[model samples]
Target chain A: MKARVYVTLKPSVFDPQGKTITDALQSIGYAGVEDVRQGKYFELELATTTPEATRSMAADIADKLLANPVIESYRVEVV
Target chain B: MRFGIVVFPGSNCDHDAYHAAKHVLGQEAELLWHKDRDLKGSDCIILPGGFAHGDYLRTGAIARFSPIMQSVKEFAAAGGPVLGICNGFQVLLEAGFLPGAMLRNRSVRFQCEHVFVRVEQTDTPFTLACTRGQVLKIPIAHGEGNYFAAPGVIEQLERERRVIFRYVNASAEAVESANPNGSIAAIGGICNEERNVVALMPHPERACELALGSSDGLVIFESVIQAIRSGRCAATLRHAQGRPEPSRGASPPAAALVQ
Candidate 1:
């Protein structure tokens, strides 16, 4: 199973990289850009056999190592 | 004073902080690895500046979960003094031990230069030796040093006098123009509500030596030492020895505002 995880700074944390990208895009003639926030995507090839097990393990990764629960949030999808 | 500089992966300034505490101030300082849970009997814990984890996920985002941070947070909760410089400041925000957050520099490039900062408060151990409104010339090197917090939180910080440092010009009188990274209200550093933890973007240790052109940063380290020599830091030390936090009023709720 493949687990794709998306990580973003929690709404409470500031996203400086996102702000810089937004400004750059605007300067490059991108229009109608109201706001921008950056996030990360991770594709993991799970060693677990069962899809259920993969999903559970992915949560563990997000909670323990993949993302900081305090300042960031993460979502995991199995395929 | 017993000091411990946290060494996260890719931390280049751990040695700088160690030297500032040991060589500059003539105190005992040690390096604590990211994976080590032991703080090793330190009274003041410093989170040094550097591209920790290469700032891979985000500035300080990846390093927030390092094993050493757990102890660092515990140390701060115990009222021990904690100083976070540059990337270390970002780590403190990521760890939620301090308020506010860092965003990319308004210039969107790595900014490395000496800037002036005005001391606004001297109540905390970090700035106890500083006279109010004194100016400091220190170097700031970071691509994401812009500080952002909501307007309400900003007001609260101001009201509590937690906003301890503001970027200024060489003259030290002018504001805004000295804003290197567009930090809100020209803020260069701030402390927590209790004022026990401080995080700043400038590198004070880098300017401690006479050859560095300015010894403005030396006073900050000296302030820490003075704080230790006095009984003011004893409460922090007692907390580190596992004494329960005095049941004073609950700590104010932390507010977050990211621009």
Candidate 2:
């Protein structure tokens, strides 16, 4: 089974990297890009398992390793 | 007093911390390897600055699970004093020794420079020798040094006087310009509710010697040493104070009293 995890800074927290990218895009004539929020994506290869188990395991891994709950929130997708 | 410096693989400031604790402060200090399982009966533990475990997912995330960290966790749980500096501070947060988290500096770049930090609370094991509002010159070197916590958590920390240090200007006002990393409340350091474990973004170990621009860092090392010598830290404090909590909020700073 394959799964993906997406981790992003909590909305309440500032993302200066995303803001800088937004500035660079605007400078390069991509003004239509009003804003950019940066995040991390992780692909995991797991042993074949039930869908429920896979999701639970992925969430557990994301919570413990892939993402920091303090400053980041994560989404798990079974791909 | 024995000071234990935990040396993670990428820890570059381990020697600096040992020098500050041993030769400078005249206290016994030793380097504890990350793979080791024992602290050798150290009275205080130091998590020095550096990119531990390469700071891959997040600073201190990987290092938090190391073998030696387990021992440190137990040590801290027993009311032992632990001080984390810079990356060490990040690890302490990840390990749950301290609350909150670090964010990329607001400037979006790694910064290394000397800044003034005001001692906000002096009741902790790390700041007992410092007078509240006294400014210390310390160098901070890190990309993700901005300290962040939920608004409610920030309020609780403030109310408890757990905010041990705050970035400040030469005049001792915590203005925005003086903040190098945009830390919340201009926080440079903080202690746990127990007031035994403390973590700070600035490198106090680097400023212990006069040749290194300032000896302000000595006050922190001295604070802990004196605390241990006078049996004023952690376990002793827990019983002597005879209160459910330890905070000097109602009492004015020693300097303020003189003024």
DockQ score of each predicted structure, in the order shown: 0.27, 0.77
Give the distance in Å from residue B237's predicted Cα in candidate 1 to where it truly belongs: 1.5
> Per-residue CA lDDT of candidate 1, range B1-259, in tens?
6789999989999998888888887788989999999887776889999999999866887899899998888788777789999999999988787787787787879999999999999999899999999999999999989888878888998899998899988777656678999888998999997788998999998988888777889898888876655645546555566634432223221111100
> How well does candidate 1 match the true structure in TM-score terms?
0.80
Residue B186 local lDDT, model 1: 93
Candidate 2 TM-score versus the reference: 0.92
Q: List candidate 2 stretches off by more than 4 Å.
A: B234-259
Clashing pairs in 1: A16-B103, A16-B104, B150-B257
Model 1: DockQ against the native? 0.27
Q: What would the per-residue lDDT of candidate 2 be over residues B1-259, giving only the tens digit for each residue?
A: 7889999989999999999888887778889999997787677899999999888988999999889998888777767789999989999999888899998899999999999999999898789899989999999999999899999999999999999999999999989999999899998999998898998999999999989999999999888876665555534333432333332323222222223
The C-alpha stretches of model 1 lying farther than 4 A from their native spots are A1-38, A44-79, B235-239, B242-259
